[model samples]
Every structure is written in structure tokens, then in C-alpha cells.
Target: MDRIKIKSVTTLAEHWGALRQADVEYRAADGSLHHLKREIYDRGNAAAIALFDPARQTVLLVRQARFPALLNGDPAFMLEVCAGMLDGDDPFTCAHKEALEETGHAPRNVRKICNIYPSPGAVQEKVALFVGEYDAQTRQAQGGGLAHEGEDIELVELPLDEALGMIESGELTDAKTIILLQHLALERGA
Candidate 1:
């Protein structure tokens, strides 16, 4: 705390997430002071999970439209692990709820993997990552996400090996999804 000082914070946007610019004063290792302005985006926090079925050696994922990717000329619909903004729920609760809503599968015996800051350079959001086990019995509804919220999610089940291979094939590019997949693969010694 002694090394940095926030001079002021000004809100730049307050829509989906709150974006603010912070004027900061920093003390360097060489005993120099520097002034810097940085923009920070805060959307509270979120949680995500990798849904795996041990019996089938497969994982359940979701595909949905991601405007940001589309805006960058990438495909609009991207394959991703089930996830959502926490709203007011705890990380675990959010992960469970999102999994059920997006894939119609409520994972059992979920184990949290880690918490990650996907873009600490500018985003003040922390995501709790988890691994959950699922099977056919867990699927209860024809989950396509909350259609009223415009979530047109599609469930994608793939063998764990094939899903991991997609990372090398340039198919699955979502970072959270990739991290969860890699973690799952490593945990299973694949």
C-alpha cells in the first residue's frame, strides 16, 4: 500500500460493468515517483465449471453467441464451459446455477480448482474455477439458457481427449474454457 496511491477515480461507464479511470501515484524501486492513469472495469465477480463425466470420459460444454468475439471478427458463437456472472450469489452457487441453466446438468461433488483473474490488466473481476462431475441422470431439462435473457445455448458433449485436442486445433479459444479443459486433462493424467 505504501508503494501506490490512488489519487482519484472517475467513472467512465456504468452499464453492464462499471468502468472507471484511476489516477495513480507510484513509487518505484529506485525511489522515483510516477503518475499514471489507468482504466479499471468492475463487474463484481463470476464463476465457471468444467462438467465432466467420469463414466463416459467426456465433458459437457456450452456454445453461445459472444458479441465481443464477434466484434473482433471471430465467430459469434463460441464453445465455452458453463459460466455466468455471480449476480449476488456465492461463487459455488453461481457455478452450479449456471451449469444447470446452460446445460441442464447440475454437477455433483463439485471441486473448486482455483480463482483466476482473466484480465487483471484492466478488469477487476475474479472468477472461481471448478470441476464438477455429471452424467445422463443429471440432465433434467432441455436447457438452452434463459431464453428471455437472449441466451441461446447449445449443449456440446465431447470426449475429453477430443475437447483437449481442440485447443491445439484452434477450435476452442475461450480462455476460461481452455483453462478448465487443460486442468481437467492434467488432473486425469491425460
Candidate 2:
């Protein structure tokens, strides 16, 4: 922050999320001052969880429609780990809630992997990543996400190896999901 100086910020939109145009002067590494304007999307922070069943060597995931991806000419339906905006809860709580609501599993031994800014150049959204263990007994509900919220998610449980294969096959392209799956693979020495 010391190397950056804010000139001004103007709100451009605030419907689904806040979008602002920022005017800033930055001190370059070469001791030069540079002025620029950039639009930023502020959609708050989020949490995502990868639910792994160690005994079965499987992971639970959800497939849902993503309008943004559809708009980008990618598939409308995306296979992803359970995730949600924090709304007001802490990262761990949000991760657990989203896991239960999107995958029908109550996770245990949840551990944080890291925090990541998915689109740091233009978006102000940091997603907390976590890995949690799940089993048959943890399936407390038939999770398809909330109908009222427009989330018609489909649960998919696959062997860890198959899930990893999807990444190379272009079936699973979500960033957060990829990170979690790779983390699990590394953890299991796969």
C-alpha cells in the first residue's frame, strides 16, 4: 500500500455486486510513478471445500449451471467442489455449510489449504480453500443445493484417480476444484 497511492474511486455498478473504477498512482520498481485506472469487481470473499472419502478413495463434487462460463462459450454445466460466498460467516463455517448444502455430506477434520484470489487483477474475491474427510455416515441429506437460489446441482462421486483424469480430459476445469484435487493427490502420495 505504501508503494501505491489512491487517486479516486467511482462506483460504476452495484446490482449483483459492486464494481468500481479506481484511479491510482503506483511507484514502479525503477522509482517511476505510473498512473492508471482499473475497474474492480467486489463480490466479497468465499469458501470452498473438497470432500474426500479416504476409505473409498473417492471425492464428492457437484455439477451446476454457470451463466458466466456459458457466456464465455464454455459448457454451462461445471463440475466443481462445494463452494459458497461467506455472506457473513467465517471461512470454515461457510465451507462446512456449503459442503452440506451442495454435496449432502457433513465434513470432518476440515483443514485449510490456503487463500487465493481467483481474479486478483479485476476482482476482489478471496476464496478460502479447505479439505475435509467424509464417509457414508456423513451423508445426511440429498444435496442438490437450494432450489430457490437457482442452484440445481447434481452430486457426483468418483474415484480420486478418475476425478484427476477429468482435469487432464478437460471435464473438470474449475480452478478451485483443480487445486483441491491436486492437494488431495499430493497428500495421498498419488
Query: Which predicted model would earn the best lDDT?
Result: 2
- The models' CA-based lDDT, in order, is 0.93, 0.95
Clashing pairs in 2: none
Model 2, poorest ten-residue lDDT window? 142-151
- Model number with the top TM-score: 2
Off by over 4 Å in 1: none
- Model 2 bad stretches (over 4 Å): none
| TM-score, structure 2 vs. true | 0.97
Please report how far candidate 1 places residue 107 from its true position, in Å.
Answer: 0.8
RMSD of 2: 0.9
- lDDT string, candidate 2, 85-163, tens digits: 9999999999999999998889999999999999899999999999999998998888999998888999999999999
User: What TM-score does model 1 achieve against the real structure?
Assistant: 0.97
Residue 1 C-alpha lDDT in model 1 = 93
